[model samples]
Target chain A: SAVISQKPSRDICQRGTSLTIQCQVDSQVTMMFWYRQQPGQSLTLIATANQGSEATYESGFVIDKFPISRPNLTFSTLTVSNMSPEDSSIYLCSVDNGAFFGQGTRLTVV
Target chain B: DQQVKQNSPSLSVQEGRISILNCDYTNSMFDYFLWYKKYPAEGPTFLISISSIKDKNEDGRFTVFLNKSAKHLSLHIVPSQPGDSAVYFCAAIGSNYKLTFGKGTLLTVNP
Candidate 1:
């Protein structure tokens, strides 16, 4: 098991603005992932944050909209750019050792 | 289309009874499956996992059974306790080491 922490556990953001959520893990993990879960919906993969390289965005997501940064093995950040009401959801970061998730950041667009 | 499905939105069971949560997957490439339990204001916790190579795996009160032919798997918590109540999520591991998670089922264990 891994201990993960996220910044700004819950946030109310104005539309058209961007928000960046940070994820820190207790130990270095090889693979880190980002996921989004809308209200009452299943989790969807956003991207795989790679250390020293570009993140791999999933089918419905693109780097321009959700740019990711992984400076090292233990930390990553996800920025949701130009947000809208439809982007209101819970964004989570996970370390894949098997798999473990961070306490999600709940984002609401107003 | 959803590759992993937990059709039951919620379930209720009495304490000391067995709580069974079911999941089905549409992808045959899934070689590993896992169950996670989540409480409000917290991240999902790892519960149990089963490989497609095996049929059943048990640890203490929690057991996971896999039926590869049916693309189905189930988690069984025997003698369910009130503390065991939470949202259970089922996930399948695909070729890229990516996981596909189900919608999750809220389980309530009543005393």
Candidate 2:
């Protein structure tokens, strides 16, 4: 079992601003995943961050809006750029192929 | 297309009773299924999992039943307690290893 620590447990940001969420794993992992859960919606996979490589994003999401960086196996960061009201959602980071998850960062964009 | 479906939005059960939650999937490629429990202001926590080749898996008070032929699955909790009250999510993983989740069902185990 791996433990993940996510920063900024909750944040309220102004529209048009960007917020970066950081995820740190207790153990080194080859791949880490980012997810989003909007109000009253299911958890959606945003992107898969691979160590030493570019992150693979899912459909309906783009890199410019959610840029990811995985500098090492144990750490990664996701930046939500040009935020809007629609971007208000809970963001989470996962490891161990989805078995373990960080507490998640709840972002409210106004 | 919603590959995973949890038809019931919410369920209420008295404490110490049996609480059953159902889930269905449209994608045949999914080979692994998992259930997660989530409290408000927290991430979903892994509860139990079942493989496509298995029909059932049990862990203490929780059991997951898989019916591959019906493309359905369910989670059963015996002697449900108030602490179990939370949003439950059904997730599936295919060859791609990415989890497809269903809209969660809020379970309220009344004391």
Candidate 3:
């Protein structure tokens, strides 16, 4: 089991503003995944962040909107750029191939 | 297309009774099935997982049963407690190693 620490447990941002969420893992991992859960929806994969390389985003997401940074195996950050009311959701980071997850960052755009 | 599916949006059960949550998948390439529990304003927590090779996996109060032919799985919790009330998510990992999750089931274990 892996332990992950995510920052900014909850945040309210103005539309068009940006918020960066950080994730720290207890151990080094080759891959870190970012996910989003919108209201009344299932969790959706946003991107896969690997150290020293570009993140691979899923079909419905893009880097310009949700940029990711994996500085090292133990740390990664996700930035929600130019937020909108529709972007209000819970963002989470996970390691150990989805076996463990951080407490998640809840973003509310208004 | 929704690869994974949880038909029941919510379930209500009495405390100390058994709680069963069901899940199904359309993709046969999934290598592992997992269950996660989440509370309001919190991230989903990994509760248990079962490999595709096995039919059953048990850990303390939780048990997961898989049926490969049907592409279905279920999580059983014995002596359900009020504390267990939460949204339960069913997720599957395919060859890509990324998880495809189902729309969670809200379980309410009333006292």
Candidate 4:
């Protein structure tokens, strides 16, 4: 069981702007991931944050749109670029030690 | 095509009864399955997990039964309580280390 701290518990952002969500783990984890849960939908993988390297984005998601930074093993950040109403969702960061999730950032692009 | 599926949108169960939640997966490559419980304004918490090698795994009041032939799994909670009311999500992990999640089912335990 890993303790993950995610920032910006809830935020209301304007359209066309970007919001960065940070995830910090209590210990070093080999694999970290970002997820999105839209209203009335399931959690979708956004990307895998790699240590000392670029993040891996899933299909329908681009690095430019959701640029990720994984500076070290215990910390990572996800930026939702050019937001819109459709981007309104709960963004979560997870550490894959049999899977543990952060509290998640609830973002509403108005 | 969604790999994991939880068809029931919501369920209402009386307290002290059994609460069963079902999940199905289309991908055979998934070797591990997990259940997560989520309350409003909180992150999804890891509830229980089962490996494909076993048919059933039990943890206190919660038990997860897996049927590989049917590609389905179910979670059973005995003596449901008001605190059990929350959305439950089914997630599967394959060799790739990516977890695919199903649409969650909200459970309402009526007192």
Look at candidate 1 and give me any clashing residue pairs.
none
Q: Estimate each model's TM-score.
A: 0.97, 0.98, 0.95, 0.97
Q: Write the per-residue lDDT of candidate 4 for residues A1-110, one digit (tens) a residue.
A: 68999998999999999999999999999778899999999999998888988888899999999999998899999999999999999999998743688999999999
What lDDT does the true structure give each of the candidates? 0.93, 0.96, 0.95, 0.94
Clashes of 4: 0
- DockQ value of candidate 3: 0.76
Tens digits of lDDT, candidate 2, A1-110: 88889999999999999999999999999999999999888899999999888999999999999999999999999999999999999999999878999999999999
Q: For model 3, what is the alpha-carbon lDDT of residue A10?
A: 96
Ranked by TM-score, the better of candidates 3 and 4 is 4
lDDT of 1 by residue, A17-47 (tens): 9999999999998779999999998889999
2 versus 4: better lDDT goes to: 2
Model 1: how far residue A83 lies from native, Å:
0.8
For TM-score, the strongest prediction is: 2
lDDT, candidate 1, B38-80, per-residue tens: 9987878889999999999999999999999999999999989
Ten-residue stretch with the least lDDT total in model 2 chain A: A95-104
**lDDT tens digits, residues B1-111, model 2?**
899999999999999999999999999999999999999877789999999999999999999999999999999999899999999999999999889999999999999
Please tell me which predicted candidate would have the highest lDDT against the true structure.
2
How far in Å is the alpha carbon of B75 misplaced in model 1?
Answer: 0.6
Best by DockQ: 2
Two-chain complex of model 2, DockQ on C-alpha atoms against the true structure? 0.79
Looking at candidate 4 chain A, the ten consecutive residues that score lowest on lDDT are A93-102
Candidate 1 displacement at residue B65 in angstroms: 0.8
